[model samples]
Target chain A: MKVGILGAGQLGRMLAIAGYPLEMSFSFYDTSGSPSVGFGDILVDKGGSGAKLEEFLNKVDVVTYEFEHLPLELTQKIEKLKPLYPSSKSIEVCQNRAKEKALFTELGIPTAEYRVATSAEELAEAAAELGCPVVAKSVTEGYDGKGQAVLRDVADAEQAWSSINHDAVIVESFINFSRELSIIAARSTTGEVAFYPLAENNHHDGILRYSIAPAPKVSTELQQQAESHIKALINDLDHVGILTLELFETPEGLIANEMAPRVHNSGHWSIEGAASSQFENHLRAIAGLPLGNTAANKPTCMINIIAEKGDKEAILKLPYAHLHLYGKEERTGRKLGHVTVQADSYEELVWRVKNVATFLPGSPEFISSIS
Target chain B: MKVGILGAGQLGRMLAIAGYPLEMSFSFYDTSGSPSVGFGDILVDKGGSGAKLEEFLNKVDVVTYEFEHLPLELTQKIEKLKPLYPSSKSIEVCQNRAKEKALFTELGIPTAEYRVATSAEELAEAAAELGCPVVAKSVTEGYDGKGQAVLRDVADAEQAWSSINHDAVIVESFINFSRELSIIAARSTTGEVAFYPLAENNHHDGILRYSIAPAPKVSTELQQQAESHIKALINDLDHVGILTLELFETPEGLIANEMAPRVHNSGHWSIEGAASSQFENHLRAIAGLPLGNTAANKPTCMINIIAEKGDKEAILKLPYAHLHLYGKEERTGRKLGHVTVQADSYEELVWRVKNVATFLPGSPEFISSIS
Candidate 1:
């Protein structure tokens, strides 16, 4: 099967890697022009022209995107010519914070209290009404902590709104949480759904630094709760392929932070830690194949290789560390690659992760649920 | 690093898949005009000219081969320009039966009584001397039970010799073996060695049909014995990358059959059953990276998809089964792909393998050391 992928970045490269063994060919449509993935037939549709879209559609049997923040008009147009997994509705909802929060509320999935603000006065009123230290994010086009600001006081709303640089912003009250977690689930064309073990994620500067799989001390009830909530959203959206729901574990309960309608960073550990990786499952789901086993085989920790290249020799020397480097030049805040450390126990996993971090110059201190 | 592979068959395709994650780029030099691997930079050197050879060398940092059956002169030329893993010496010994047997004898490994014959009369004499029921095989370029004939009596030697079609043939007394097994080990440039657990193989019509890993009922003493024999050959050859030794398990002990200097079909189980796959280990060894753990994580069975495609949906429905297709059109007696089934126990593994076999037409009956 020939698959057309939107956004030719590391995720698409990894997806193509996983898809090759299944005898699936890939053609990547990169709007960024400078695609990170070198192999496969790539169409650089920088202008998103109809002719290029037609050519890409003619080359593939189905369409899927690695990045959810795609132009909805382009995705919708592609959907008319070929099958698109997760549909344009997923992109539409995920791109707008208000739409996403409304869907979460309709599905009974808990999220932070917030109000949409079109003016500075409304932003201040929402902040004052909800409490202090609220997060104000653009209603559209925001990710990786971009186009966002933290208002510690209601008096700072004017500055936050102006800096956000959007017509409207969603002001959300900050929820006190113990840790961040993410649940990745896949729904196939035949309506088969499978969920991977929850991953406990650590972030610095709003970028994911570490993700530990089968998050330690997760109760059966909590896992079921997370699964049920995600299942509700998946079925409601009629979503196909991988859907990742990010959560904040609070003393009150689990609160939905955000969700990505694609293969996510937190689920990268599945490449080695689980029986079937998220990349494989996503491809399988999109191709209408049966979902594979999502069970974790061992405790695993994935550390992002950001900005700079690590000592390849030193990292490869660690028997438990699997190094994955994207063929890209180093740039500040850019994700070059990641190393996944697997061990029989969480204790050994933590030790190995720390050892691997030494080779990565600016890596954050290794931490996990157990650690 | 850029690695050049001699053959662009499924093995080379899989090697490329394994190497890509290590941030390695591949340029395949396929002597056959029809290269099966679709991805990567492929150069079809069908005429074997100096210009094409130089072009291939200029594209890669190091050279290796997936298939050993190549023109020794060409390999020797490439070796002078680039570092070739396992070297030409290993290839020279592996290409001929007499040299391979001599290496085994010199290393004090046990083998069946055999004699070389240059004529049909000599072949009959050797069969008579070996007391009939002997197997006659070409002295060079024979694999997968090809270029071989089984003689029930000395009178059948003339037909057998003619059928082999080689200038010289080796006639050996057929030993009564309990099962066929293979040991896969990798040696790095720094002389670090790691061995995967032995895999019990089953063949039909000279083609391998199934391989069960961590062969059931194997004693630690037996495993160590297998390991030590392969280790001796690896060190003796001063070989780097994967070295696979096929053996016949008789009541007396393990008798050496033959050796391949590159990754073998028997080690395909390592892709999922072992902590590190043979393909990954081979690349790591050739790249001068540290060897990974070779321990088996579960009892696994690899069933070869030969000559025909299977019911993919049916096979995929078996949660334990992982399908790998080579993107090749099905033809008679051709290896199309393989399915790997992993289970926590041998009992469950056998059951799942049988279930998987139902989908693959013409697959041999499921058999293993345990079942």
Candidate 2:
């Protein structure tokens, strides 16, 4: 089978790696020359020539995307030529904050209190209604910490509106959650559904830094609630591939945050920790193959290597550490690679992960609070 | 780093698969159009042209071979341009049965009684001296069940000699053994050495059928003796990368049979059963990276898929089974791929492997004697 992918980034590269053993070939199309050039056979730089996109699509059996920000119009056109997993409508809903939250509300899924606004006065009204310390975000094309700001008081509403720079915006009530949790769910074309264990994530400057599988210390009841909501959302969207649902653990219950319609960074630990990896499962689901077992082999933790090129020898020498370098040039705050550590027990896993983290360039503090 | 390989069969393809994540690039040289052409960046067809050989060698940083049958003169020429792991001398010894057995005897390693013969009369004489029912093998370019024959009596000597066809042959006394076993070991450029657990192998028509890891029900003292012999051979050769030693279990102890100076088929279970795969460890040794842990992750068994392709869906549905397809056109009795089954217990591993083996094309009887 030949698979075509949009936005050939690291996710696409990992997907291609997983597909090779299954006898699947890959071609990629990206606006810029993507780093996937190393693994992919045909790279269509869409920025250089518009006609190459059609030529590339003709050679593949199915189409998919790595990044959620892919334009909906292009996705719909590609669907006409070949099957596109997760559907363009799902991406359309996820690319905009308002639409995503609205879908959650309509499905009776719990989410933070919010209101839509278009101007400075409207932002102030929404902020006043939600109380002080509210978050104002653009409806579309927003990621990381960009195109969003926290409004502490009425005096800060004007600057918050201008910082967004977009007329249409979503103002949401500030969430005070105990921890951040995520669930990765996969729905096959034949309607087979599977969910990976819940993951506890920690972020540094709005970028994911560390994730622990099975979300240590969480009750079984809480995981069941999160799985219920995710099942409802994927069924309603008629999703065909992997979908990641981010949640907030509050006093009441699990609250919905946003979702990504592709393989996620928080799930990288599965490559070494689980019986089967998320990248392989996602490819299996989209290709109409049987889904693999999602059982964990051991307690696992993953830490991202951002920007700094740490000593490779130091990381490779540590026991139970699996180092994955992206073969990318180092840039400040760029995710160059990650390391996954697995242990027979959770205590040992934490200790090994912390010891490995200290060898990193910035000496990240992902496990400081575990003690 | 870039590495060049002499043969582009499944072994070379697997080596390239393991090298990609380590930021290594590969080019292959083969007499015929290699199957690795789909995955490799360069394919030098040695049969069609001679000029491309130098051009191909110039692009690689170092050189290695997937098979030990590479021509000694060609290997010497390549050594002048780049460093070759295992050295040309080691390959020379492994390529010829007489030199290999002589080295074993010179090093005081226990092997079956053997005598070199130059003609049919010499073969008859060697058989008479060694006793009846002796086996004869060709000097070089022999593999699987080819280039070998057995002499059961004095009258059978001419037919056995004619069956071999080659004038240079090594005739040996056929000894009765309890079982067949093999071990894979690696030595780094800096003298770092690691040994994988012993594997119990079964062969049909001289081709490897199935392998069980850790050689179940064996005494630790016996394994230590085998390891000692392997260590002495590798140290004397100053070997780099991986070497596999095949042994026969007898009433006295373990006796040497043969050895491959590259990764062996019996070690395929290491891809999932061990903490690190043999292919990855070989690449690390050649690339000057640190050798990883060689401990087994669980009790494991691997079965080779030959000739016909099996039902991929049925194989993928089996729990804890990892399917690896070579993406090559199937030919009768040709190795197409392999499936490895891992489990927490030996009983469970055997049960699962047997269930999966039934789904294969040949329905091999390798696991029937486990009880």
Best by TM-score: 2
Angstrom error at residue A161, model 1 = 2.2
TM-score of each: 0.96, 0.97
Which residue pairs overlap in candidate 2's backbone? none
Worst 10 residues of 1 chain A by lDDT: A362-371
Candidate 1, superposed: residue stretches over 4 Å from native? A46-51, A366-370, B47-51, B364-370
Score candidate 2 by DockQ. 0.67
**Per-residue lDDT value at B298 in model 1:** 87
Best by lDDT: 1
lDDT of 1 by residue, B118-155 (tens): 99999999999999899999999998889999999999
User: Candidate 1, clashing residue pairs?
Assistant: none
lDDT tens per residue, model 2, A196-262: 8899998877788889897788788988898899899889999988899999999999999999888
